[model samples]
Target: MTDLVLRPMTPQDLGDVLALQAKGYPAALHDSAEAFLSRMALAPTLNLVAHDGGGLRGYLVSHPWAAGSPPPVDSVLPTAAPQDCWYVHDLSVAEAARGLGLARRLLIAGRDAAQALGLTRSELIAVEGAAPFWRRQGWSLPAIIAPELAAKAAGYGSSAVFMACEDIAAL
Candidate 1:
């Protein structure tokens, strides 16, 4: 972690961000550049990038969003709106950087940013069998989900599970 610098993500990082995303996620899960930029505009501090000697190695895109209302993948939010909790839209690390604990660092940074905004809860849609990984990070699935919400999760892809961290303090 000492060798990598964590900083607020800027438009300049999109190229590397997209490349890392492609390597880590299925095409169905990929967010368009406009979608990424829109979220960044709403919460610049929450969106972050990890830079090392090799260049940008990882990134996290999060924003202030209403809980239980995870936006569909690639949905571009054009303006500020009332928000209840922090939403982690995406987190990806380059294949070469996977073993270095970079993802954890980015998560911590994003969580800290959200906390700064007086937000205590966080939610994310875990796609591609990522539930176990998020669970290990202290997020958990609701015991039961509403039908409409379950259908919303389905839109993310077959294995997507809606998860939340009820207390960011615990993270």
Candidate 2:
């Protein structure tokens, strides 16, 4: 973990980001280069990468989005990002780097960027049984979810959980 650096995600980093995705995420969770580029265009500052001088260790891809309506997985976002809340679209850490706290560090950095933009909340659809991990990070499931929203989340995976943190600045 020594020499690990957290920096704004750049276009040049997409190839490594995609490689990290293939290793760290389920095949179904993979998003295309077009999708990644769209988010980077929408909120470049909110997207981040962690590199340990060797290679990419982790990444956090987020953007301003409407709360309760997560964009579909692997799809490109709208030209203009909705400024409602911070939407954490993806967070992945290299298997070898998992125990070094890279994921949490990337998350905190993304949250700080969102807060600076005046976003008070954050939302994410946790796939692959990641809800518990997110819960530990201060995210919670809403008491009620719209049927349509639930269906959309199902597109992510049967186990997808739409979670949110109401007070972004607090964490």
List TM-scores for all candidates, in order.
0.97, 0.97
lDDT of 2 by residue, 1-171 (tens): 889999999989999999989987788889999999999989988999999878989999999998888999898988675789999999999988988788889999999999888999999999999999999898999999999989988999899988889998777
The positional error of residue 167 in candidate 2, measured at the CA in angstroms, is 0.4
Q: What local lDDT score does residue 117 receive in model 2, on the 0 to 100 scale?
A: 89
Per-residue lDDT, model 2, residue 114, is 92
| Off by more than 4 A, model 1 | none
Could you tell me which 10 consecutive residues in candidate 2 have the lowest summed lDDT?
A: 73-82
Candidate 1, overall lDDT? 0.91
- Where does candidate 2 clash, by residue pair? none
* Steric overlap count per candidate: 0, 0
Candidate 1 residue 15 Cα shift, in angstroms, is 0.9
Per-model C-alpha lDDT, please?
0.91, 0.91
Off by over 4 Å in 2: none
